[model samples]
Target chain A: MASSSEPSALPTLLVFRVRELRFLAALRERYRVLDFFTSGSPLAAFLAAAAGGADPPRALVTVGGDSVRVDAALLDAVPSLRFVHSTGAGLDHIDLGECARRGVGVASSGTVYSTDVADHAVGLLVDVLRRVSAADRFVRRGLWPLHGDYPLGSKLGGKRVGIIGLGNIGTLIAKRLAAFGCVICYSSRKPKESVSYWYFPSVHDLASESDVLVVACALTRETRHIVNKDVLAALGKDGVVVNIGRGPNIDEAELVAALKEGRIAGASLDVFDKEPKVPAELFSMDNVVLTHHVAVFTTESRSDLRDVTISNLEAFFAGRPLLNPVLHS
Target chain B: MASSSEPSALPTLLVFRVRELRFLAALRERYRVLDFFTSGSPLAAFLAAAAGGADPPRALVTVGGDSVRVDAALLDAVPSLRFVHSTGAGLDHIDLGECARRGVGVASSGTVYSTDVADHAVGLLVDVLRRVSAADRFVRRGLWPLHGDYPLGSKLGGKRVGIIGLGNIGTLIAKRLAAFGCVICYSSRKPKESVSYWYFPSVHDLASESDVLVVACALTRETRHIVNKDVLAALGKDGVVVNIGRGPNIDEAELVAALKEGRIAGASLDVFDKEPKVPAELFSMDNVVLTHHVAVFTTESRSDLRDVTISNLEAFFAGRPLLNPVLHS
Candidate 1:
């Protein structure tokens, strides 16, 4: 409990949960932490008590990947809250429009996890192109000795790769693949003036010219299902798709049907429309590689994320500019 | 059968078998193809017939990966052989010293497959670091929804990577990883003069400083089992290894023991001590990613290899210099 009498006492930071012990310990060093979810108190009672307190918590910190909803109704309960911080790069779970209208500033761990996510996207692409995971499965099943030669995989070099987004992560993916002799192009909202990679106005045109299509865009209304049936058809039978972005950025059902009918050659996905519940058909396909939503979940990235998040919270309390502010349009 | 009556007839090309129909069709366009294994002729009878003819076969072309031994005995049997061409970069199956002494020109597909090999090596490294294969296995086993969250992986950026051989394949690998922000160093027979990557004279010291060690050197008596127990110990508990080179580059038994005991973090192996005979212990380990010697077995590389092999054979028959000659020490 933070004391009202002591002027030197630390401020309170309200959180739903604390998954990392190190992150929790570090937060506790600067602020008095209140975990509403872990405290076993009813949410209504906790909110009422927090609202009645003389010095209520002014900032809220939350971890990503739990689908934690922070809507208008919840914000109305915390009148003293002026800042919200998410320890992840994705802002899909946070209602940015609502936060902006309420004059609440939002911060996320921006670009701290970009290198890791790009590494994972390239990893999945190569795995699909060279059959790394599929061959690993084949060798693990003791089928190599029984079966003579594993099927030949396509080469990454000289293949046309179409990136769906040319953001920070997508740009890094392009730079890495160029070293392997791959021809790079992209289909972003508009052409990035700095890059020389060929740009297509639409994803369909990009998919038609690409041997592999990588989805790395944000999950907005315009970008949702950006890779649908038309795009898959354009990618053709020998094309591969690698998705490291949010799941909804691609049409999951259409992707499954394309893979099932061999309309597209293969796909390597790290995110699903409803994660932890991947389509059962993908389990049996040797051409497909499926992983949990873990592109940014690395030990090094997590440490960086913790630092960025703590800094954002500290800056908000100290009346300083946030390190990674999510500017609302 | 080549007709001796015609002086301008194409030269004969002797092969044990013609596995790739396309390669065989392409070769027959320029030469009289003789496949002893497919012809069902006795080995001695075939050799005697090939040698006794007036227009004896002057060149031999063979596909790689079958361990088809081209030893001193085989060379002695083919006294008229002027050239030997292998459709792969590796020359372990062919006796280079014997070929040099016999004045027989040898050609291999030099850097045609270097880009693909480097791509697979980096793919395997990222897979091992990001748990790409392991996470795929977990998802396939229906564990992600049940287990709640998969374990975190290590990051690839800012890690020290030590390459065992700074040959064509290794240098390309360093170039690709440099784009990912990894610190690159290497250990080879001798430090290369053109590049500025740090060099270590011994594998022990190289492994001591590397977060990941990639083996990409050729297989020789002095190079076999170069990453032995001592090197593994120096790599410590957090080090990873990726081998895209020939089998036996790393001691199989010692690597298995170290991985099982957690002496090292993880490994991604594309080759083993025995082809199609991976150690059963590695099958169950989650920290290891195994493939069936497929680093260079891509469709595009195969096409390039066919062209290189055919070019070498054509050059030999036409009394021209070989395209990619293997210099014997």
Candidate 2:
């Protein structure tokens, strides 16, 4: 289908990675969709051909926080690439500094999935605190009548909850939990003036005061492994951790060890250091709640993402401000 | 140790169905705790002997909403019984009308457990909507890497949540879920003038407009099987139901049928029609999250309950008002 002789008015939207095929149709209505997936060419050869061609894609769109690295080398190959729509909340896979240096306009799925992600964080937190999943298994295994009542769970009311990053997602999680009568506190690089929640200068201090520690920060050099061994130790044996942020945000090995030794009470992990490959030790732990990285993935959020992606692309082509511009500096 | 009779000034308090032994010591501190369990006699015999005694028990305190029926027969046996302290929230186990007629002053756990129950309700709601337990199971089975991403869950935001019975627990559940961007509405005997949440006169109407239905009402003749086949059908295919209320509040047979037939999306049940004996048909369903009815059972609440129980006892003996009087005139 690469035998186009006519120059259509629609701008080219070079999709790097999008597994959700339904979104492609909505995109095709506006843009000349050049999906890399359907092209079925090697990564190097595809770039070479696109680079060598007369009309290279000027705007690119991608989805998910996958293995695709939009780095300096890739930017060099696609010299005409001026605008990028990540269509995902996370920009870890996309090299923001490189993109900024190249004068590329970057947009992401701004606040679109925040509610979903936050709701999931609270869900995981509740699951960990109340042992919802463990009791579910016990009943399924027919242990209720045979074994009598399940173990009593801890109450959520009056317990201190320390959020690692009080961004859009973190703030929402705090708001939802506050209604359950949980005392709120947070840890960030700097305290957010807009909120009255107690701010902790360090993660260790936050963990020490918190009955539950929720990680909702982004993945960056300074933030990676923020919830390390010492922080987990400070969290104490009665403490629980809920990570809806990036996997590397918490030291996974340290968490596993903490769980194994009962240094921490429990954890609810949605992301892993090696995602889709959760540590096998967590399999048998009734204290921990595990899920494949899907805090932001939902049918409702998919529509929101598609809208954010298409709107950013449309705005870029119309010489308007990007709806969700990243690289603030 | 059953010691020799000593003329203590403390009044007698007959104890029943307190499995938490730690709470027992606290009760003994205030009064002469005559435990029915330690009597080693049948319930009928115990009541008979207590009735025959020169100093018949005037006050009774109980916990855990168990199978110890506090009815007219027992009330008749202990004719001197004036102050009844049911330390659990649900008064379905006790005949409230009979107690009122007999001039027995009744007090309960009051608002002490409302927060815990409400928190659990929201926890169960999120679990059902987001499939937290199922996802945990999938990740634990090591199916993520092999099977790719687990199925996407429905978002909790913008969800129409219908809470049946807008009492203290239900009101708290509504409040907590409202902060998650959920549209709150409820069905009760009558519309509550205090809260601004939309009121649905019938359970079916509530289910019709709701994406999620939370059964938070108490069990009674009128309320039993309130969430029957019609109500569940009206909830539709994308709808989920959460029960932190009594199990019989929802018809187990009807609910099982709906789940099996895919009439409703899912359910998270902490209670069952035949508690401690959950429906075997629900054992294999991944959509249903089950627990052995421990929503209000927490270590923190136990302390609160102990305090409430002791306060009510002291108040009764000191000729003051009951702390959590139920069966209002």
Candidate 3:
């Protein structure tokens, strides 16, 4: 593709898989844009060609949520790559260790989506506990007059809420629920010194004591299937589950079984084990609320994400510290 | 009704239309119960017969959903009635002025249901704003795999939320939403000296400035239809309305029209204008979430209501102050 503007003067900026038009247009104004998806070639072939070019791209933008992998192979293919910006909050898709080894910097979406995800976590929790969705369905079906009264929802004020990854999103969820008079506790990799709430060592221990389990952790090797059969069983018959993180955080099969057998009271899931493909069993259950991975996709958050991503890209090119840097552990 | 225990010596406790079996069983252990529904006579006839009896009831328990009216006619028929304990938090059905004129003390359900109602109010607000019910419906209908991304929900943080009542329930709702970073404002009959939230003198003014209007006030002559067409129009196209108070607080026809015409964004209503007979138009709309008047009827609140009402009766009979007294203005 040819451009109308002088193509070589601006700093070269490569963009991988994700294509948000407004964000793309903004980036195009500042840089000689190299979008891999629009290159009419494979990502590997395009990256190899760009890397060997006279004006090699030192920075690129990609998506998180495991949609694209930025591992050693991709890093090696683009030798000039010094910075990577992920549009998603989670960096599980990117090989952080590989980037760290190569002395490359990374910026995630940061606290931009935290407030929106936390808002959704609370929304899902309240919907499950108070049966808001169920009640809405009852009224929509015109059952109120015939049925006399819909089943009473449980009170939410004094529930013991256990948050599974107490990072930015989990902390925000805690702060919101604390105002609703919920007792908050957490099971992080280790206890956060700044947080005053009670801490448990493991998911099982936390689940045993909690009335609700809100999963807001990142998806990693140790964290995958964190909320399995034992944890669900420990949560007991009246337990509620809310997941705003990745689908793989909890064992979906076990969760579906637990919900089916009435081992747990209910669940509100925004992410599923498979993208777009939700469990068929969940389609018929009223005890669970399922959304198509939209906890952080609010219109407000989208605008913020675009702005933050643009800022991250601009800051990297200026050799300033990244606005939303991610730590590689 | 004849009983196995001595009935004549016990203090007669007349009961109105609410029939919670567990609460009734608990009440039976304390007072000589006289149920109007089970008395085999019209309420007027039953009141006349009980008034002329040798052992007159000095106290009675009733409900406050306008299901039973404890007005001048009933008060005149039962001259011996000294106190009334309404099982519902609302006291609109009970004529406070008539009770005050006859020196009859009134005990409402009080703060027992306040927390529950506030929880529901926040739940409904979050559900409506985030489209939790709509998203749930989408996933349940096997639309996720086919439709890809569901429509995005609006963010709750930074929203200007105007509370209509700002009473016990309204205050709690304000407190909960404040933690989510919402700007709290309110419209009440008069400005509250203790409340620090921004106050508007009229619903129209509040609607003009707010993105969300939460209705948590009582149903009185002055308050009925307080959220009329003009107020709704002022709330604009993106404003959300949450009603956990009473149905008539909003003009139902006007609300349906506003929703249909896209004058407002959406609504999450626990109470409706006609209640059991909700507008059929709302049934098909995804923007509105309707529940059949069960906001405060949680299992936990029900138990609390039972205990509070029983305590109020015990206090009245023992010549002690009522536990949940309503001030007559």
Listed models, DockQ each: 0.85, 0.81, 0.80
Per-residue lDDT tens digits for candidate 3, residues B1-329, read 44313545678888887577888898878877888867778777778778877787899899866466988999888889999888877888888999998889998888998888898888888888888899888888887767555567899889999999888889999999999999999988789899799999988999999999999999999999999999999999999899998888999899999999999999989888775789998888888888777788789998888889888888888888777788421
Q: Write the per-residue lDDT of candidate 1 for residues A177-229, one digit (tens) a residue.
A: 99888999999989999999999999999999999999989888899999999
C-alpha lDDT (0 to 100) for residue A38 of candidate 2 = 81
- Model 2, A1-29: lDDT tens per residue? 27123367777667877878788888888
Give the C-alpha miss distance for residue B153 in model 1, angstroms: 1.3
lDDT of candidate 1 over B121-223, digit per residue (tens): 9999999999999999999999988955667999988899999999999999999999999999999989999999999999999999999999999888888
| Per-residue lDDT of model 3, residues A149-219, tens digit only | 55678888889999998998999999999998899999998899998999999899999999999999999
The reply for model 1, stretches above 4 Å from the true place, is A1-8, A40-55, A327-329, B1-10, B36-49, B52-55, B64-66, B327-329
TM-score of each: 0.94, 0.94, 0.93
Show pairs that collide, candidate 3: none
| Residues B168-264, model 2: lDDT tens digits | 8999988998899899999999999999999999899999999999999988899999999999999999899999989889989999999999999
Per-prediction interface RMSD in Å: 0.7, 0.9, 0.9
The global Cα lDDT (0 to 1) of model 3 is 0.86
In candidate 1, position B128 carries an lDDT of 96
Residue A59 accuracy (lDDT) in model 1: 87
Native contact fraction of candidate 2?
A: 0.93
Stretches > 4 Å off in candidate 3: A1-12, A16-19, A32-56, A327-329, B1-9, B37-56, B327-329
